[model samples]
Target chain A: MVRFEDISTPARLAEPGEGIGRDELSLATRNHGLPLEALRYDLTPPGLHYVLTHYDIPYAEDGDWELTLGGHVERPLRLDMDELRSYAAVTTRVTMECAGNGRALLSPRPVSQPWLVEAVGTADWTGVPLRALLAEAGVRDGAVDAVFTGADHGIERGVEQDYQRALPIETATGDAPEILVAYAMNGAPLPPQHGRPLRLVVPGWYGMAHVKWLRDITVAAESFTGFQQATAYRLRQEPDEPGEPVARIAPRALMVPPGFPDFMSRARVVRPGDHTLEGRAWSGHAPVTAVDVSTDDGHTWNPAALEASDDHRWAWRRWHFTWTAAIGTRVLCARATDAEGRTQPLEQPWNRGGFANNLVQRVPVHCTGL
Target chain B: MVRFEDISTPARLAEPGEGIGRDELSLATRNHGLPLEALRYDLTPPGLHYVLTHYDIPYAEDGDWELTLGGHVERPLRLDMDELRSYAAVTTRVTMECAGNGRALLSPRPVSQPWLVEAVGTADWTGVPLRALLAEAGVRDGAVDAVFTGADHGIERGVEQDYQRALPIETATGDAPEILVAYAMNGAPLPPQHGRPLRLVVPGWYGMAHVKWLRDITVAAESFTGFQQATAYRLRQEPDEPGEPVARIAPRALMVPPGFPDFMSRARVVRPGDHTLEGRAWSGHAPVTAVDVSTDDGHTWNPAALEASDDHRWAWRRWHFTWTAAIGTRVLCARATDAEGRTQPLEQPWNRGGFANNLVQRVPVHCTGL
Candidate 1:
């Protein structure tokens, strides 16, 4: 078992020496604390994984933190941290990733962070159900959306900036216990960098919706449009304009491309004999139903053993496969299929920034005597 | 004229005491910089406005930015910032608002920015024509989505993060100069916070499509997804599930609601006397053909003067009306009708995280001695 000391925090400070431009870190290429060669099973070894958040890291504050739920509701509420924790606690092992994972791999390598693959990670999260609070608040009819805000602030276009995003009411109060108002990560109180007091853990979706340092919950018939909603997280192009303002387009939610590959194409160092290949698979909208591995690119394929599905359907599943090959150079690949019948593709279509990269996993490896 | 120095830089830092909640800085409430009273105008002020982005602020380098056009074209090439800027430059004043503007005003205020009512803004933007770039780049048949990415970075959960979004091809290569690769804002170099080196500015739609710090431009047949596309800025609960996970729902682009009010309500803070009221009107799918104002809270109404339309068909138009009232208190309202005959409603349907809040505008004013 890997010890906690072996877990290296992937967070890096934006320093001058760190070349700007595409050199910045991105979801697709940030190096986690684990070897890219090792393919683990079940839980993502804390070292080799991805992280997600909605707002900037909250400051360390011990002040009284309260969550208020009001507006159009039968009964308004103000729940403190302790009060919220006292309620039934639920734990879920889910896979959470940034919406833009795998972006760096896009051909032409979009201008954002030149992520060298590995933009996702899975963790067992623990939190309270948001629905219970809504039930306690007695939701009223016409409650359209729920707005979540965080404590971090910055300067955007020289204006005071605070991050905010909204979720539909149905999702906020759904039967699935996956939507969590979380306080813990990987079985520990969230660190200051990861929304200490409170944050949201929304499985199957990108990290943006899981707001950090969550402070207020308001039920409304209308949607909210703070900086994050109206301007920051939006598309700006015209529906028929055909490449006028490349960015100006209608805002749509992030999606895991239907044909995206589920597992990472990786190789493990092995002796010149028999060996097994392993990896993991997950989806944003559905559960990982199966994983397939390819030994010769797409020329041939074989089924891999998949771990049991986790409590959170949005989380990813671990898988492994054994194969014998002549010691030499080989191309390895993996693919995933979700419950919705979506499967990984051989290659992803090229986009400007490489948003949803679900292309088949391909890794080239050279064999040496072990 | 508002002098540059006297104008306060059109930006401000967030106050320390500001609460940490989505609604605290939402456009809906007066406290969030977007005052409800400002909605009386048809054209949103430049200072009080909305902006969108795909990546974090890019490091503003020299004229290092370039525009590339290739794929199924006669010639594939790259145009640096100077080369692209050498082409003809055009300027237009337009109103750009999030599709979910006024979302917070909904009954339950869906789960988005708790906008208290101010998610709209107008700006005088200058940029190069997209047609020129396409002509220089060359077009292809199978091209479907034009993806955009930025240089911003953050940590979500425990991982590094980057922002990205995409738009359809038709919107990328449109006829009108509505789409712009903007380097200047309000006739000056765009501040770093607003897409410094370069950005896409498509007027008349939600903000997500306008990718900031744009880097790459790809022509493809399929849409990409990271977190932003598949999860964050989507509309679920269309059929209205009260408490479902947001991921289970399919994402739909922002749509103009049916039966919306034609004109925004107007009010004059003056002694009991005759005064003229004015505001703006427009639609997402169609232009605003006319607007009508009501002083009796919808009981009676009068037609307002409509301004000539602009090149940006999706832009809102200014309208005004004169009315007489007795001393005391009065409620004013307005509604708008789009070219397609869709009218604003007295109240918009509630969704989770209040999106698409286009209800009729109602203003309450107190009258004094004549």
Candidate 2:
């Protein structure tokens, strides 16, 4: 786990909480991402939702943990979890994927928590928007970045510091790809495994922008050059180049119909006959323009039926592909394009962190009846 | 597991050996394939080798299993394992990939044993060549297909029968991409996980071509229409379209020097510096004509150093790409073309069975020290 750190200050010592034990370790214990097989449905069940974390899930006690708005703000303010709850709340369902999704598939895989194709999930986030928080704090002129701090902290690449990341002030203030300081998940109070009392839910960006166990929101004058913004979660050309900061989940799609396992299973066994394949697709960057499936290994593709889309920009739209299963093994594949024509590649463009692997998904099945 | 059944005769009743219990069910328990991360190394260790099976690893006593040659031959012959060993033996290092290697990557994945990119491995096979055995059996006129039968059997899609498959007679007696009834792996006696007493090793083709637990070879005058051949292992467009029978390993390449996972990890994280990236490439149809790597996705590609060529047609040649790792997330990708000029597609043409997923490998890595 790469904990974004601010080494400029004395490192905040980690407070004691429930540490995950070896016996309790699971993909979930490590804050596992959503298993592909879990996508076998339209609405993602809260328990089945994917989870990605940059550090251990922090245990927070309402009395000890608080959200403070300071730095370039005219009125600095601090509020305990209870006090923060007094603000009006809104609910939005958002799909967030780690920038590092499909990292292992990359050649010369980047180092970090080895990730596969999971690292993504969707949930209904309930809380106050950063705009509301920033308004109350009264941001002063020339606030360039909103530096967010989390309760999680650790040593990253030999540097000890607290988990922190920053968003351009414009993003924190903008309404599109909305930013939320969430206190609940899927209609329930956030679990400790998630952010617990509070977490930043940046709808469009990768998980790195969503600071979990969020404790402080600082409006800063200069661009925050904390390790994460300047070093980690970036696409670089050379070892010394802190290329582009990894941002928004790229255009992509996924489908989970009933009967798929919780993990990748080779192909589904079916009687020789007609069958319908269905799933969901979404883009953090733009609306999904098209969803397609190929029964002939992509030699040809058929457009799938998509459900009516609503105003929720971050929610994935459902789709379906119907085909017949002959007596033999068959490969089924799906791909999606966004409003800007951003479709998945046959291969995901590689990044050092293996982020945003939106490669076309291929599925194989066997028509056992002969 | 989809076992081939030959209802033509009373089914070869399954003899259980280490049957996997519900608690033991796992990718490994169901005769799993290699994990993609294991491909980081050139030569797959016997322990790390991938295993694909249509049925449970049957208990084949050497005394009970024998190779029998009959039908359209000058001399019908049967030989026990020891007797078969009396003939001259040759050893070859061959890399075999399951036709279903990248099945899960396909959308609406075909139903079968779910396999990802790790369904492949390289191993040293020791045995007598089939051409030599065919020579001894003496080919009679009118022989067209060499129908091969295995000892394992079960009801597949409701048909009770023995496992069976066939190959063109010319391939059975040809020299390139040699075929062998192997008895040993990596110089050790074949374990039950592999074919215990004897198994066919058809290098370059998918695992289905390598019929396990060999029992009989029947030289016939027409194509064999067994379920495994006529129905399964075929790439189809429509259910009625037999499409094409999947054959020969498609041109493909994989590389991981060391310090990678047994499965796909996000990207290999490393300190920024110059690093030598290397691995192996192979083809069943034509010799690997060329291999190219791109540090910057597919925008540009540089040829890597391929090991000196040799007479071994099925042996994968090693290649190396030396480049510097810059900081942040970077993508490394490799693509291979064969002698026939068949290069991996930016997307492998899709097929119903999800066979021949030889798409280029894309690797992601993080240069952690920035």
Could you give candidate 1's per-residue lDDT for residues B1-370 as a string of tens digits? 2111221111122233222222122111111222233344444332334432221224455377775655545567677778767878877665665555565345543433334344555567678866567667776777776666665543221222366566667777885436787777777676554576777777655666666776666666676655556544555555332332221101111111111110101122334567767666667556777788877777887788877875656556767777675666567777788766777677575554345556776665545452
**DockQ of each candidate relative to the true complex:** 0.01, 0.02
lDDT of 1 by residue, A1-370 (tens): 2111122112222232222221222111111211232224345433234433222234344368887778768999888888888999988876655555554455444433333444555677788988888888888998888888776553332234456677778988995535889887778676554576788888766666778788878788887766555544332232222221111111111111111111111122223555666666777756677788777877888888887874556566667777675565567788887767778777664454354556776765444442
lDDT of each: 0.54, 0.69
On residues B234-340, what C-alpha lDDT tens digit does candidate 2 reach at each position? 87866678678888888887766222211112224556678888777888888897889888866799999888657667777888888887666667788888899
The 10-residue segment with the lowest total lDDT in model 2 chain B:
B6-15
Candidate 1 DockQ score?
0.01
TM-score of chain B of each: 0.74, 0.87
